[model samples]
Target: MTTQQAETDDSDGAHEERPAAIETIRSRRSGHNFDAEAELDDETLEELIRDAALAPSSYNLQPWEFVSVQDDNALDEIVELAYGQEHIAEAGTAILVVGHSEPETADEVFQQWADAGRMDEAAAEETKATAVGMYDDDRMGRDYGIRNPSLAAQNLLLSAHARGLTATPMIGFDHDGLAEFLDLPEDKIPVMLVAVGPSGGEEPERLPRRDVDEILHRESY
Candidate 1:
């Protein structure tokens, strides 16, 4: 096993040894059933979304877009698309995670980071201009959406877990049907569904990780 993998295994055991960050990691688990009595307040959901949006992307392309299905009609609609997952309908929030490669509002992507003070006007404008340059570049344009969007989804899931809520990242739905149901234009591809709500059970089990030896390499694959 590689050092990182060893550390991960040790960390699993180390949760009992360490109490701060490890504890948070240990404490956060995917919630299956949730408390229907409590719903996600708007502010908290926005905060969770803000944290999730901090996820990194290639060239700052930031291709993730979410459709928050909070209304009963939408929830019912998503349940059918999600292959009839019961928790998906019951969860307080369901984010239809989409990978949008060519957004009509690319400026908004950089504008967000700048609005958060992560970049100044000069830097944001520079970045935004540079972003436009690569719009037609196949390597950066098309694939950036796929690569960055998946990472952002992970960020959203982890952030949701950190906020004392449970989340399930599901791709077991009908993608084409979902796209049709959402009435998305060509720019949007429904990649996954994230269901979030209060935990109604014990900490869920972690899926076993492949050893680092298998996943990592020093120079070449």
Candidate 2:
């Protein structure tokens, strides 16, 4: 990561320096090639997942799980489930971002909130009831399941970049096969597959993106 900093003024008329995370966000690229021989140590892998888990979730439901594939046999299976995506095998690690369709931990989370004094008992119970009712609906539950984990996936990519690793998020996969391979429960869904490792020494040119003017709308689109 670069040591360069950007400066900005805050509301209190004090200057605050922007974090290197901005550079990480700007420079992060989706890697298509990775060094096949490279490997990620357990500590680094754990840290990556820790950073990903910090992503925000609706009602703090935190409905995401990860499966890290590093063993040769597991990688081989993942490659097949990912439709022969060679990068999955080449990368040092592959992470399966799993999402839960229901807020199964609502009771525990709300109890903690009340215990920590963040919320009164009555408020916590009411909030939990509302969240449960909304998530009980099939469509809403599914959407939250996928959407919340996607946020974590993005965080994972950025964390990898900050650690000087190349990572790619791929959606092209056999979802049913993956679920079967992982033996996921009915409520758990495979949201995304990410491969992480050192670069293969050949970097692709950055692709163009739409300019701010083209993509941005004032108040209404």
For each candidate, the alpha-carbon lDDT, in order, equals 0.74, 0.88
Pairs clashing within candidate 1: none
Model 1 per-residue lDDT tens digits across residues 104-135 = 56677678878999999889889877777776
| TM, every model | 0.75, 0.91
Worst 10-residue lDDT window, candidate 2: 2-11
Count: clashes, candidate 1: 0
Q: Could you tell me the lDDT of residue 18 within candidate 1? A: 50
Candidate 2 shows a clash count of 0
Model 1 C-alpha RMSD to native: 5.5
Clash totals for all candidate models: 0, 0
